[model samples]
Target chain A: MLKIEGLRAGYGAAEVLRGVSLSAEPGEITVLMGRNGAGKTTLMKAIMGLVKTSGRIELDGTDLAALPPHQVPRQGVGYVPQGRRLFAELSVAENLEMGLGAGPAQGRAATREEMLELFPRLRERLHQRAGTLSGGEQQMLATARALCLKPKLLLLDEPTEGLQPSMIGAIRQVMVTMRDRGLAVLLVEQRIEAVLELADRVSVIEMGRNAEDFSRAALSGAEGRLRARLGV
Target chain B: MDFGPYLMLAMLEGAVLAAVLALMASGLSLVFGVMRVVNVAHGEFYMLGAVVAWAVTTLLGAGPVLNFVAALIVAPLVVGAMAAAADMVILKRLNYDPERTIVATIGLLYILQQLTLMTYGADARPVVAPFNERIALPWVEWGDKGLSFYFPWGLSTTSYKLFVIAAAVVLIAALKLFMAKTRAGLIMRATQGDREMATAFGVPVERVYALVFGGGAALAALAGVLIVPIQQAHYLMGGDALLLSFIVVIIGGLGSLSGTIVAAILIGLSDGIISVFFTPTLAKMIATLAVALVLVFRPQGLFGGTSR
Candidate 1:
């Protein structure tokens, strides 16, 4: 249900996502693979309306190009940015409340409850200040906060970075459950195997242009070739 | 034969007086906390409240209870609305320029004082007690040979000054609770903590500025109401309180409510005690010097908890 056409974005003078294009369908995990500075995060931020973006960005035939950051959630976009930028001093509960915004839509708290059930460890520390939480716990809190917005498309940036294997497994299960629940996910992570394992389709980018778009099954057997391309 | 009674009486008077000063300073402190705007017109708000109460009671034939309560409630709310109007007329146009806003408010201060003088004529308008009776405080006889001290009991016990103290304590407590408990209070705190982040949260920051200014004006108005009973509701009442409130805020730590209360009490007691022994002018001079010295040593005042 998400689409991007000729998306061009940058911070200031230096252009990052140079006329890139990609899309994720309903109930599917679309993995975006790229190097450290290859504009993966830029594309996600552009979609969330957090960064300056030009060209076409739409979901279900509606443009969200000029919407403010706070309005992005109402337009069916949920973002979990790198570093899990949770409001540091606020408690997990308050942080979650903030994600709910001033809008009067129902099920915001119920969605949080569902995320807590999925990440049951968060259920215990529901009232703890987010700054006091461990790295994995903070990531979960950030992810859980975004999910509470109840968006149709979720953009996750580096969800596995600096996280333990168990947490990564939990995130994978969450993604699968959410996909089955008909929530489209645009997954950005460094873990090639984990991403490939979950994504229904994969799109690789090099220097802001799409290098390849292939089904997850096609990339499964060509692991050696991809490792050679990555030179790792 | 004993000076103990005189000293005790002086101490009691000082506390009563200090409570009045503390109330004014707390209002100034709250305004500074969130908006970071130093409202020079704060004392004018207080004076106007006192003057308005004085006039309303005397002219309308209202009793002290009704007059006093009405004064407290009406004056601040009116002044707060005036401040809100000022926001639309003047401050809103200034766009957070502290130097400009200060000049504008200080200008408003002078204009208010002048207008009050022009209308009320330079006489000290007298406000009477509810019942025309002089009650004497129980006299503490200390010396022999008919050399005795009379601490007046009747008026002193229910002095408008004491009433102001009770009101001040209640007002401050209510404000404290309102700031901590409400949703709007959360928005205010967040704005004070980090304005941009709060704005990003979709809080209208301009509304915050207006509310803060209104709150400050309301406080000054309360101080005005407190002073109406004991002091004459003269136009110049604002001047003395205004300068003193500035020193109180600085001594208390900028934008700290608790600090303002403590510092105000300290300064008021010092002002009263020093005034008893010395001329009022000299007492103010010494108090200013003392505050300067303390601030030199501890720049953030005693409670040093600024919002930032």
Candidate 2:
């Protein structure tokens, strides 16, 4: 399980995530929903240790907040940042290899062959530069690159933001697979359809603090309340 | 002497010049490509190599070939370690801010140059070539013998000069393979492409920066060692080298490796050939004019992509 308790973080003086607490259990997809500037991304960055934070971030009894950012991924965490920040100039294969590199791998990373199988579109364009790939393809590549880490906890920030319906379906399927395999998926998303389809639990953050939480069963009963909180 | 023989001689000299210049400038380009920091102390690294070579040769007091061989092995390693240390102690402290690093490296440049002058003194010192046996180059003539090859007068080069050219080609090829086929090279390219993404992906960006800075200085040092036998080592020698290398790096495009090599060859050969026809100063003027034209028309450089 991945857990964050009263996490406060931001760039320099201004704190974006203030006293927010949440948890995503194993074999479950927990989506975080909030309006713009509500600190969803800040919470994700705090979990990844990309931003300065004060609070507890623990994964499977290991204190992640104590580790450096580069060491964070080694503790069974895979991150696909908000923009699908693939190494643009590098070829698709090279980018995948980077995920499977010696620095990131902790004996459980996926092999190149396994990743190519997972994203078949990447197989044909293995040698193509990541920058030239279509929007959907880049997202797929980004997701696959993260999966190469074979993390027990996957943190995806808006993976389907600019993707097409088919691509969204493809990524949604990957999340389901990961959840079924007993990985903890902490996703920051806005699309209610994707949230309805994949979320086992939903948490809402308002102005950097946890406003509400719901399980899949509880979410159906409280749709109106959740929509009102989300302002959508 | 026939113009043909003179041109051949100039070409041979140009090739030697191109070899050394390419090695030096490629290091500069590599540093900029990976760290995005301009190392003003790069030339001082070159000078340090020559000075170290002189020290090694003088200390060994052995056969010239053996001493030269040892100097080659020691100079780059010593200089590389020094440069890496400097990166950690100085550049890292500055956070590699572009403008601050330029000023910091300029300080480092003076410190290194003055330190060398204090120890090695102001006089230029020469290191004997390992083996400078002259080999007469043959020329073809359509005279009475009908395309017979003859050893033309004043058409010969030293064996050491040939070795310099061959060594450079081999080193560059090795560097290419290292970049294209190795895991370490992939990490370097990854770090170069996106530093933040690389850090997020578990790359030790700080260590990589130090390694690149060291590697780049090592290349400049190697070039210094190579040219020391032909051109004597002096504290001020790095000034001209720095200027020429900057010109080559700019003409080739900021961080393009292939372009650096191509521009080195273009500049080195023209320097030799043009100097043969006109004065050395005029040749330099023409080269400077070329740089001006390239900058005005193609600011991104000859091979630089529109966007870095």
Best by lDDT: 2
Please count the clashing residue pairs in each candidate, in the order shown.
5, 0
Per-residue CA lDDT of model 1 for A136-223, tens digit only, reads: 8988887877777677888889887898898877777877888898999999977768865887988878888887777868888766
> Residues A69-186, candidate 2, lDDT per residue (tens digit)?
8778878788888999899989998998888762344453346777788899999999999999999999989988888877888889999998888989899999999999999999
TM-score of each: 0.71, 0.95
Model 1: runs farther than 4 Å from truth? A1-232, B1-3, B97-100, B111-124, B129-157
Q: Which pairs in model 1 have colliding backbones?
A: B135-B154, B136-B153, B136-B154, B137-B152, B137-B153
Which candidate has the top score in DockQ? 2
In Å, residue A90's CA in model 2 sits off its true spot by 1.7
The stretch of ten residues in a row with the least summed lDDT in candidate 2 chain A is A102-111
**Model 1 accuracy (lDDT, Cα):** 0.76
What candidate 2 gets wrong by more than 4 Å, as runs, is: A102-110, B143-148
Reference contacts reproduced by model 2 = 0.72
